[model samples]
Target chain A: MFRHIVLLAWVAEATEEQKAAVEAGLKELPGVIPELLRYEIGPDAGVSPGNFDFAVVADFASVEDYMVYRDHPTHLGVIADVIRPILANRVAAQYSF
Target chain B: MFRHIVLLAWVAEATEEQKAAVEAGLKELPGVIPELLRYEIGPDAGVSPGNFDFAVVADFASVEDYMVYRDHPTHLGVIADVIRPILANRVAAQYSF
Candidate 1:
């Protein structure tokens, strides 16, 4: 499987409503996008004092399938409409496992 | 379950051997640590530009179990000995799912 993981840190001024919108937007993806085999998104658990605020872990059968998720209109809409406004930093990693 | 994901970006001067050693050290954790339910580590696949260099995804049954792995001597040793030396930046996220 190809795994794609993204860690996001929100800007200091980001509101709780904005973060919720981000989560709500993401939760809608797996149902709409068939190539997404596994989709998991969560807020940081606060076990660590300093850590990224959110995480996204998605799986695909192949890199091509992942590209489908990447370019899908729903996913792009979420990024452009909600996530980018509050996104302070992002760290992503993709690999075959 | 609780998930912990860490993204690492090494300095420009970091050597391949050093990165390999980091992987080698992490591979030993699941064998020695009972609390680590699932562990997946991989170098970035290069699909995205300017992504983090590597990722470590770990799962635990509960937050307490994750704490065990987090504080494990072997894991600490790796952070202190191998990873911390050449590390440029790190982003981590812990969550419950």
Candidate 2:
């Protein structure tokens, strides 16, 4: 399986509602996107401090499937409308296991 | 369970031998540390370009178990003797799921 992990830091001024909207947007994708095998998103529990505020871990059957999810209109719309507006920093990693 | 994720970037000068050693060292822990419920580590597939080079996803029964792994002598030794020497940047996040 291909694992795509994204760590996101929201801007300091971002409201709780905005963050919730982003998480909610992410939670909606697996149900609608066929290429997404599994999706998980959540807030950092602060057990390991001084890092990004939110994280997403998704699985795909292959890199091509991951790309389909990546460029899908629904995913792109969430990135543009909900995420990009409040995103401060992002670091991503993809690997097969 | 508590999931602890760590993303690492080896210094540009780090050699392949050093990277391999780091991964090998990480792989040893699950056998020795009972607190580590699961561990997965790998180099980035480069599909999500322009980010850290490696990532680690580990799971524990609770935050307390994670702390035990975090501060374990063997783990600390690996960090100091292997990882920290070649490390460039790191971003970490922990959450319960």
Q: How close is candidate 1 to the true structure, as a TM-score?
A: 0.97
List TM-scores for all candidates, in order.
0.97, 0.96
lDDT per residue for candidate 1 within A8-92, as digits (tens), equals 9999999999999999999999999999999989999887988999999999999999999999999999999999999999889
lDDT of 2 at B9: 91
Best by lDDT: 1
The local distance difference test score of each candidate is 0.94, 0.90
After aligning candidate 2 to the native by TM-score, how far in Å is the CA of A37 from where it should be? 2.1
lDDT of candidate 2 over A1-97, digit per residue (tens):
8988899999999999999999899888988898888787799997655978998888899999999988899999999999999999999899888
B91: Cα error in model 2, Å: 0.3
* C-alpha positional error of residue A8 in candidate 1 after TM-score superposition, expressed in Å: 0.8
CAPRI grade of model 1: high
